[model samples]
Target: MGSLTLSGRTALVTGAGRGIGRAIAIRLAGEGALVTVHYGRNTKAADEVVTAIRAAGGSAFALRAELGEPGDVEALWDGYDRQVVEHTDDTGLDILVNNAGINVRCAIGDTSPETFDEMFAVNVRAPFFVAQRALERMRDGGRIVNVSSGAARMAFPEITAYSMTKGAIDTFSRTLAQALGPRGITVNSVSPGIVDTDINAAWLRGDEEVRQAAAEVSALGRIGRPEDVADVVAFLTSDAARWVTGQVIDASGGSRL
Candidate 1:
C-alpha cells in the first residue's frame, strides 16, 4: 500500500477537515509523511482527522485557517513557522496539496458579483497565493498537487463559474511546473470526476438515477470514492511522479469523454 513512499517528509494539506481533503491528508500520513491538516473553520472535524492519523501510528497535527484571505495565510504561515521550524530547524516544507475550493452553482443569468468574487477568491486566487507561500519554504524536490475537477472541461449549465475557477487551476498548475522546474519542484493537477463524498453524496451515490447515469457513462462503471482520488493525489506527490509534471491526470473513470 505504501508504494508512494513519502517517508521522512512533511506535508501540508489545505481544507483537510473532511471529504476529499481529509482523505488525502490521511493517505499522506499513512505513507510516512508528517502531515499537517488544515481546515477552514471546522475545529471538530480537523481534530477528528488528527486523531485518526495519530491512531494509525502516524504523525499529524490539526491547523485551521480561512481560505482565500491574506490574513489567514499569514496566520497559517506563522503557526507553521513555530511548529515546523522549531522542530526541524531547516524549515523546508516537502509537500503541499491545495485541495480546498468553493463551488457555486449559478447560471450566468443568476450569477451575482459577490458570488463570483467569493468563488474566484477561494477556488482561483487562494491556490495561487498558497502556492506562492509554499514555494518560499519548499525544498528542491518538493511536490505540489492542486485538486481540480472535470467540470473544468465539461460544460455544465449551472456550474459555469465553478468550471472557470477549475480551468484556471489546470492552467496554473501547468505554468507553475515550468516556473519551478529549475528548482526541482513539480506541480500537477488531479481532476476527479463525480466522487462520492459527503459534500456530494446525493449527486454521486445516493441518488439512484444520478448514480446510474454516471456509472453508465463512465468507463469504470461506477462513481469515484474519496479514497480513489486520494490515492492518485498521493502518487503524484511522490518520487515516481518526479518526471511527470505540468500535466493533468484525470481520475474520472473516463467521465470527461
Candidate 2:
C-alpha cells in the first residue's frame, strides 16, 4: 500500500506476535516484503498478524519457536525454510529483525544468578544464534536489524541485567556489520525508549502521573508509539539505508537529551 520499497523481498521478524515486533512485521509487509512472523507461544496473536497482513493485500505467515530454549534457532529456521519454499520457491532471506527480548525488573542487589542467566539467554544468546542461522539463509545484500534499548546506554538500575544484555547486542551489531561488510550485508541496532506498548502497559497505562513522568523523559515531551520505532526499522531494512551500517540508530524520541 506504500512505496513498496522492499517489493519481492523476504523478511523474518522475531517476537512478532505483539508490541513493536508486531508493528515491524506489518510495516515490512506493507512495504511489499513477504514476512515471517515469529512468535514464542501465542498462536492466536501470531495468526492475527498474518491475517491482518493478508487482509491488507500483503503476504505473511506465522512461525512459532520459543527463543532461548534448546534448539530454538534450528527449529525457527526449519519452519522458515518450509514456508519460504511453499510461498516463494526460494530459501534465502532478505531481512532479519531480532526483536524478541525479555526484561527483568531488578537491581544488582535483587538480581539472582538464575535471573541474570535467563535474561542473557533470552536477550543475548537467542539473537546471537538466530542471527548466526539467519546469515546462512540471508542474501548477500541482506539487512539485519537488532532491536536494542536506550537502557543499554543509560544507567537504568531498575533493569541492570536487561541493560547489560542490550549492550551485548549493540556490540554484536557493530562487529557483525564489520564481518559481513564484504558480503554486502548491513547490520545495525535500534534503541527505543518508553514506548507505549503492552509491554509497558502495567506501568504506563491508566495512570496519568506515571504516564506524564515517562513522557517527560524524552525531549519530545510525549510517549513513543510502536509505529515510531517500526518506521525507523522499516527505513533500515530498505535500500535507502544501503550505506548505513554498524550503527545504533536511536529511536527514542530524543530521550535523555
Model 1, 128: alpha-carbon shift in Å?
A: 0.5
Winning candidate number (TM-score): 2
Model 1 clash pairs are none
Please write out the lDDT profile of model 1 over residues 94-138, one tens digit for every residue. 999999987767899999999999989998888888889888899
RMSD to the true structure for each prediction, in A, is 2.0, 1.8
Segments in model 1 whose C-alpha atoms lie over 4 Å from true places? 1-3, 85-87, 202-206
Q: Estimate TM-scores for all models.
A: 0.94, 0.97
> CA shift at 148, candidate 1, in angstroms?
0.7
For residues 14-103, write the lDDT of model 2, one tens digit per residue: 999999999999999999999999999999999999999999999999999999889999999999988778889799999999999998
The whole-model lDDT of each prediction reads: 0.88, 0.94
